[model samples]
Target: MEPLRTENLRPLDVSENLWDRIFTVAPLVIIGTVEGNSYDLAPKHMATPLGFGNYFGFVCTPRHCTYRNIEKSGEFTVSFPKPDQVVETSLSATPRSGCSDKATDVLQNLSVLQATTVKAPVIAGAYLYLECELFRIIEGFDDYGLITGKIRAAHVDKDYLKVSEVDEREQLMKNPLLAYIAQGRYAKISETFNFPFPKDFKK
Candidate 1:
């Protein structure tokens, strides 16, 4: 006869690294810079960008005012940060912990572009800026939310993106994609692959 060991089980209350767990499962993470009625509630909201081509957007919990502002205002700017700006990008995720009143003070100071379609601002240093309008908002259980926006405009840096010169090897050696492993820690992703999924199974 053998006895099962209950000692192997530790108290499971909360996830040790929820962000890391989600990051591994999620294929991509897009930094969202927003402006709402009360920025005090959530200084900045950064989440994974999910949707189809030309209609790209993000899915986030509805609790935050950014979701409501986008629902009412119908626009937002998805900014992709530069590798060197990782420090400032990570600071955007930190809750209002400093003495700054405006949550976006640092973002603004980073030399960003003013969004035309929306009141929100886009990171000037970003290689691409996706301007979007709220197309649909899917609500579920407590705090669980899914919001989709239609890509209104795309501002890309002509210096970086090019077809003939653009290659995986070039992007690896020259370009660095910002990746969030944990909450604050970031890594430069030099590896990339192109895997197109079925139209019906789009994220």
Candidate 2:
């Protein structure tokens, strides 16, 4: 075989570019609810997918408040925002940014639920909610802490299911979620092309 020609393989920008790509492919919205206050951060920097097949979950490493809370409480929640809630979703990811206030201003009326296992609150209007318990906490070399949450429960909204014929595609179709990219930048699923999974996908 001929020597492989070098192409786009270049140094990854750890901050803006590298971190963003991880969140782009499979976005995860993490809600860190502690005390009476709820602070959310949808991490753009995540580890490779772990767990069993389609039932797998993306890794999340928190460097600030969320990490502190999860380290203390050993529990957290991940909620999928609805399509219409993309703006709010993006705002929630902002760490101490004023955008969070703006997003909350819009979603002030949104309902929140108490987590069964964790102190963190769940978005009542979210498409899906995962109640997670801290399984492992790996301290990274950088200013980040890798948190592995074992999903104890997965809650799907009732309104999202009108019949026995539940189609994840159809449910997600209506709520095309938001994704993190760079410094305070976001992208919508509408702009990206999607493909269906194979029939033999492991659950």
Candidate 3:
């Protein structure tokens, strides 16, 4: 095969928003929390499991209710929506009206269930649910805060489970997952391939 041509890149202005240019594909999950007497669900794309432990973290802005609610209550739930539940996930991000409660409105429209270890709610038809307690909140990132949580309990749909006896690709095709492309895009991921590790790789 011919070697691909490469172009030397030059530094651009820092004022340009570079997140979209990075093209990171992240899992789209709805973060559920308790706000006053109501429940709040917000969709977050910049989330990932921290290290190999039971810690999960997401980037959140202080202006959002999710951050405030978590700060107040110290607990939250995470729902990993399936491809078919994209509408519900998007609905959770709807802005609140000045006169009415947004959380009440969202719960009335979407299907949710009470979490086991947390006081928050989780989307009912989601592929996975995680109940978490706030571990730490790291600030000093300008306007964004990194909220880390200690996962207390987790639940997964049997259909989406990777069984040792079953083929992984077949299971994924049966239950397509939802992915978020940064900068206002989403993908339904059903196809996958195993990573080709070099021979004699050490653990």
Candidate of highest TM-score: 3
Top-lDDT structure, candidate number: 3
The true-versus-predicted C-alpha distance at residue 56 of model 2, in Å, is: 7.0
Candidate 1 residue-pair clash tally? 0
lDDT of each structure?
Answer: 0.58, 0.58, 0.90
On residues 133-197, what C-alpha lDDT tens digit does candidate 2 reach at each position?
Answer: 87777776465556777878777777655475755656546656655554455555643344677
Q: What stretches of model 1 exceed 4 Å from their correct place?
A: 1-51, 97-101, 182-184, 192-203
Model 2: weakest 10-residue lDDT segment is 98-107
lDDT of 3 by residue, 1-203 (tens): 98755467656567877885767899999999988877899999989999889999999988888998999999999999998898998899899753136888898889999999889999999989999999999997889999999999999999988779999988898888999988788999999998899999865
Q: Which stretches of candidate 2 lie over 4 Å from their true place?
A: 7-24, 36-49, 53-63, 94-111, 158-172, 182-185, 190-203
lDDT of 2 at 31: 65
Query: Per TM-score, what order, best first?
Result: 3, 1, 2
